[model samples]
Target: MSEQTFFATAPAGVELLLAAELVELGAATAQAARGGILFRGPLELGYRACLWSRTASRVLLPLAEFPAADAEALYAGIHDLPWENHLAPDGTLSIEFNGSGPGIDHSHYGAQRVKDAIVDRFRARCGERPSIDSRQPDLRIHAHWRNGQVTVSLDLSGDSLHRRGYREATVTAPLKETLAAALLLKAGWPAIAAAGGPLIDPLCGSGTLIIEAAWMAGDHAPGLLRSHWGFSGWLGHVPALWNRLLAEADERCAVGQSRIPPLFASDHDSKAVRATLINTGRAGVADRVRVERREWATVKPPPGPPGLLIANPPYGERMGETDDVSALYIQLGERLKSHFGGWRAALFTGAPELGKRMGLRAHKTNVFYNGPLECRLLQFRVEPEFFVDRDAADRHARAAALNRAISDGADGFINRLRKNLRHLGRWAEREGVSCYRIYDADLPEYAVAIDRYEQWLHVQEYAPPSSIDPARAQQRLEQVIAVLPAVLELPPDQVVLKVRQRQKGASQYQKQAEQGRFHEVHEGPARLLVNFTDYLDTGLFLDHRLTRQLLREQATGRRFLNLFGYTGTATVHAALGGATSTTTVDLSATYLDWARRNLELNGIHGSQHQLIRADCRQWLTRTLDRYDLIFLDPPTFSNSRQLTESFDIQRDQVELLRQTLRLLAPGGVLIFSTNHRKFRLEVAALADIHLEDWSRRTLPPDFARDPKIHRCWRITQS
Candidate 1:
């Protein structure tokens, strides 16, 4: 009957949108405030907002304001309210207190004080106090304290307006209904739908965006799907007026359903497709929304004019997923350019930088918050002008500029690299080596390890010390990378760059990339698979080239065992060297798979070559099989979860050596090696065993500069 002050709470970035929405919903006056909107409207208008304001989380009607300088003041301020007028003495209630002030530093304490004052007031007045009901309350009171002032209000939208009651099933990280609506509104979906444009969500998780879009386009009230509201049990709720509004909404929805546009939803995951189908049925948009299970790469537009294509693709927030995610964005851009010309596209992502990888220029950008994560909606017009070929043109430009910079200076580094290449290149060709180290930190100013894997170069920048300026280090690295392509006569993409740091345990085995690009390289008579991008170390260890050769030469008729057998390079050598059988042990399933591939590549498989996935230390104690030849190269330090106890080369070498020697038959040879630079053989501890230093013999000629790269010992039972 009369206009009252009302507050509608929304997400931080959605306040302006919510303000505009409330004004359109017949509010007398609406101003966007921090975190919410303040408006003046009649009771009927509030009911309309509750039904139609898709961006607002809740609507609160203020009843009183008072100063609460302390706890007693807070109690007195709340107790002074006319609680009986809002709720019956025997009814249930809940208080949601927010903000911190002089006396209320915690929300729970403030809520407790407010609840105590109300129940105490009721008890003193009628001797029957209302009980607390958190889930469903007759009266939901909200109190805000700031600057020692409290504003109390009655919450008329319960359980967050985003819960439209249609999402009975959901997938991981489903977008909230309010946020989805905000994204659609920001993308101008309403204007597009008004012109009879179709909508498609190729990576729909649970169909939140499609359902929200359908409701917006069809003039369907979001609250109509909801069964209950905060005012449903409130004493002041006018049943007749609310029923009149419900009838009006029903009639509008019935007529609007026919005006809905064709909406399509799909996902690569079958579970996600099923979830979308279930949610669409529950949202009553099943007939209007065509849902399917399809991969993003295969999804095509419906046979009609271009429209809006929006998606919330996987952000790849976890480790080891960046490369795949980047590739996905690149592929998505290619698809858009090749097929969806003239279509409007919007991609909402937590990683805004990834949006650039899409290879399309975003003409417009809008910021939104998905809970605590700040996200961006990148808007693009899929046209020829917006297409960006980052890999071809941009990469060439960068390389050309880098080459120009290098030509101006950097003679010292270039001369040294050429000298090493001329000398080592000849040695590699002479020895029939396809993979070998060409340079190892040759110049202190340019600290990097450059290895030639056929025509490709794998350059590892040794992580500079903390004292070195990082900017200077990066400049040196860029200069080195720039000059490598020209000096080596290889394409820029053929050169892979990575930072090499001190690795402790299984971290060295952790995936650095997911490119899944593996190249075949030859060593002696064996062919092995080496992945330059996916790992810290190429599957084949170049430093072990000479060692694997010696094993092959000595394995004509003996059984060979390879421990800590990463990728089983040494096992491949033994198998090809005519060993009777080969067994390779490691802790990584991924590495084991790689080993299987390597063995298969060399035409060595079946019972003769065994690949076991187990901690080398644990596996050593379990195996009773003896071998005539064994190679053990454990990490310097490993605390992998698969191990019962952490292994340190210095601390556990004695026991590890003993276990391996026990598996060694009489007169058998066991070669032990470690890259721990400071490692020393504890001779006195192994008094009964015979040990000889093979480090000098095992060290390859290319690694002569760094003899400590690895230390090998020939061990035998006394």
Candidate 2:
């Protein structure tokens, strides 16, 4: 057999593991590449990899490489390839094209072009083209374009090796099979399994990890369970060689199964346990692998020496989940310390900090990408020597110091907070509100505003003056974090902390985190998605609660427009208020998507509700569309590069109001608001326009505690 170059795809962090597996499988050379591995070897090496490599998602053999600067060139280049030599003209195939350079930007379009070239070539030669089969295709072709060069390959390991012909069903956040294999390999499970020690996955969700471990221990080829391979349909496939390999695999599987060590799997969810059983049975390891429906808190070690106790536990990636599972990690740590003392534990999680909460030091940690989330596989030797409590004690001591310092002002702050919550909670309940401010710097030392959104809390620490010690300020903030959860009867993780510095311009809109988690909260008749952790401010403005209500109440059968519509909460209120139509304008695509989701959540969508992604200032200047009612809430200062110029509300309010007034219909009310603490309405500059201060009346009861929360005014050009 001649030497051939091949590529094997793996999940982001498992690329190196896949490369190692390839090297072990007798590849002449294997090197890690982004999302996969590149290697050079004989054709048999490729076949062996496709059959046995556990970490590889796909095995690809390059068929052709050519310059494809444009779609036309891509089509011509692909069409010139000897398609008939790879697949029968009557066979079905699917084309997967990725990457782009100058002219090609869309993957779907690129895939279509490649598909057209293949079919056109066959049609021209044999007067018949292969049928397109997206599902269960006879052949799979992958195209990669980079820097005006395209590499077209034949996918020998069809339908990602992670499928493994198992997993009839799955629960939420199911671990991909290949990733499970990678984690097991990284944890040195193979050597442990060979020692005849029992393996356990107490938090197994669908048993991907356990099954992969079982196969590794038994020396059963991971590909034995798969029913289809891209090479099966290829004209060039050496069936005799493949069958010989399959026979050898079967013989090895029989011996491996007999030598397999005990495997135990358990989960709190019965559905997950059942799923594991079904999947393991399909993988031909059901009899060897025992699964039980058991919670992590009570899961005991298997009745033998511990091999590897590995699990892909629920990693609380989102805010709500983080709060919900913080205690789970703590409990898991306690379990490891008390029960699984001699076992080596490999725990995979998104938030590595949560692992610290487990109170055990990790002996080794490997970074892996589980989908879009970068995760850590923490390897721990669950021994008495590793269970040091010094870190925990120090953490407690510092928290205690901060608590003591904050106690100096805690009495006044807590009393003020309770007073407001009592009065405002009653008012909010009576008014059907789920989100409202509970405390707004009631004590100067506790210069933070706390808002309750249903069960979650958003705490914004106001940047203190330079005269205040930074250390003291941080201590106070930490104290607030420690006490607020207990005071609010919520989990400590439920309290999202943010520093609210005076944002000069558009810096406030810059993402602080990319959690992409949004919580739906109610304000009167509308439902809005309020994100507490991703920005300096929550998507829904607590201070503007009453103002949004007013907009809803007065917007019936009127055309409504919301400027600077952060997350489009106000638009939802207006639409709920029976606004005939609404247009929401904002500069951030993130906020626009949020607004769209908000409207969709409330079932308020279609052409009647429009979301525009543009600087509100620029849009207002050129708009011919007039609204019967308008709500303009400009930022205090915004120098977003998207805008033609920087915006300062105080300096540009007159011009902005004038432009807005021109778009207002007769008798239409244009409501403007700002959060600038010292903002003043330029009454004289807009004397010709009808203006009235609604600042006092629009203040929600919760916001009244802080008089400088916001300012509002009603303007009309009548």
- Candidate 2 at 189: error in angstroms? 0.6
lDDT of 1 by residue, 25-62 (tens): 99867888767999997899889889899999999988
Worst 10 residues of 2 by lDDT: 315-324
Give stretches of model 2 more than 4 Å off: 315-324, 390-439, 442-447, 451-494, 498-718
How good is model 2 by TM-score? Answer: 0.63
For all predicted structures, in order, the TM-scores are 0.82, 0.63
**Over all chains combined, what TM-score does candidate 1 have?**
0.82
What are the candidates' C-alpha RMSDs? Answer: 5.2, 12.2
Checking candidate 2 for backbone clashes, the offending pairs are 505-637
- Residue-pair clashes per prediction, in order, are 0, 1
Model 1 clashing-pair count:
0
Which is the leading candidate under TM-score?
A: 1
